[model samples]
Target: MAEQRRRLDPAARRLEIIETAERLLARDGETVRVEDVVAAAGAAKGTFYHYFPTWDDLLDALRTRTFEHFDARYQLPTEVDGPIDWMRVLDELAAAFVGFTLGQERLHDVLFHSDFARRRPLPADQNATIRLAAVIRAGQEAGVFAGLDPEPTARLLFAVLHETADAVAEGEDCERSLAALQVVLRRALAARPEEGSAQ
Candidate 1:
């Protein structure tokens, strides 16, 4: 007798299917087929259609999921072990972003650099810029960042991160580029000392 596959609820089943497709996409690029995804996920064709009515719908979900994973890596710190080192937080965020971009090269390109991506951009609020601005605002409140407009500052920093990561992805030396980027970011955002502090 063959072992039975455990049944999953609607939400779990949907997420499982999406994640399975994500793995396949990462492995096979745009050449990946719906049948390949379903077969690999141990899901029926009907089940896939239940979650994603069309192939494009699945791609959209995949893009959203990829961004979610990227955002989760740099989410605002809810709990601190000790004094918050905002600079270190920024550094870690930059490093994590770079690591993800490099580690998931094919997936990143397929989801973000392809023609399909140009046609469908993420909504404003759900973008990485918004998340970075939130971090900047938190840092400003903590007195670690200067009194700069968080949104614009985040936009600029995001551009820097994006371009630098692209450079690394396109053959620039990762260590050198990343180190320079970190220095540039820290210097640009560091809070200045009080003007009259010297006695």
Candidate 2:
């Protein structure tokens, strides 16, 4: 008699499909096909279509998962007893961004730099840049960062980090790029001398 295969619940099964695709993506990049994913996942073609109606749908889901995975690394505490070390927080956030990009270089490129991804923008509120902007606002309140609008500064800083990580992924010197990032971030966000004096 054939052994019975245990069935996974909806959420678990969906996650399994996504996880399988991630592995295939890491191994094969954007060239990975839905057939490859389904085969590796041990699921039927109908199952893959049931979860993701189209290939683009799957890519969209992957982008969301990747963004959330990166965001989870730098979530700030909602409550604090004393003054926050905004600069330290920023450093850690920068590290997380660069580290994730480099560690998942292939996946990152497929999900972010791909033409398909560029056509489908992630929602604003759920994006990683918004979270970084919140940190910038806090830093401004604490007189650690410049008093400029947090949104655009956060956007610029995020771009810098992205480019830096991409350069490193393309075989540039990691240490030097990181050091340059630190300098750029500090200089760009640091409180002006006048602002410090006023405080």
lDDT of 1 by residue, 4-55 (tens): 3346778888888888888877777888878998888888899899899987
Cα lDDT listed for each candidate: 0.82, 0.83
Candidate 2, 27-76: lDDT as tens digits: 78988998899888788889889989988899888888887776576677
Q: List candidate 2 segments past 4 Å from native.
A: 1-6, 195-199
lDDT of 1: 0.82
Error of 1 at 118 (Å): 4.7
How far off is model 1, as Cα RMSD? 4.0
Estimate the lDDT of model 2: 0.83
